[model samples]
Target: MLQLEQFEVRERKLQFIKEYDVEKIHQAKLIVDTDISSSVSLIELAHMVGLNDFKLKKGFKEIYGTTVYNYLYELRMQEAKKRLLNSSQPYYLMI
Candidate 1:
């Protein structure tokens, strides 16, 4: 019975960590999406979203299947391509 109680406590702790990691990853993604042009460092982002750098990096990659920098770069590139194809503005202005 004591062992079973200890196991239950361990499971609860693991569940809490998992939920917290998910929340942090979601916030990180939001920050990335909201300001892709901003040159924020990963450490800074981690601090902003209340996560340590290593956990933030690992959790972000786990949740999104890409590194934060790569995700932002992909988003920027896609947006640029969309604008180039659809906008009437000059090419230089788009850049």
Candidate 2:
């Protein structure tokens, strides 16, 4: 029972989210592959994703069930775990 305009708008938003996820994956890959710092600035990432600071923070939480910063932290942590498991890094570093 949705109106046409509303449906179109929802579709567009979903498309944007899909693209955003792809971009996140690409950025994560870059972080993994390069010596770049795992640190990502909030405002900078928001700008890269085509959203203002607050909207990006709120919208990302709404869509992803977690805050933007926490999500990135978890991602980096997971990557670190992988590296620790696969490489000869000291177990202390994984903690």
Model 1 ranges off by over 4 Å:
1-17
**Model 2 compared with the native: what TM-score?**
0.53
TM-score of every candidate relative to the true structure:
0.76, 0.53
**Root-mean-square deviation of Cα positions for candidate 1 versus the true structure, in angstroms:** 8.9
Q: TM-score: which candidate is best?
A: 1
Clashes of 1: 0
Q: What is the lDDT of residue 47 in candidate 2?
A: 60
lDDT of 2 by residue, 1-95 (tens): 45777667656665655566645544533443353344567677666556566766655654455666676677767887788889886888656
Model 1: per-residue Cα lDDT at residue 51: 89
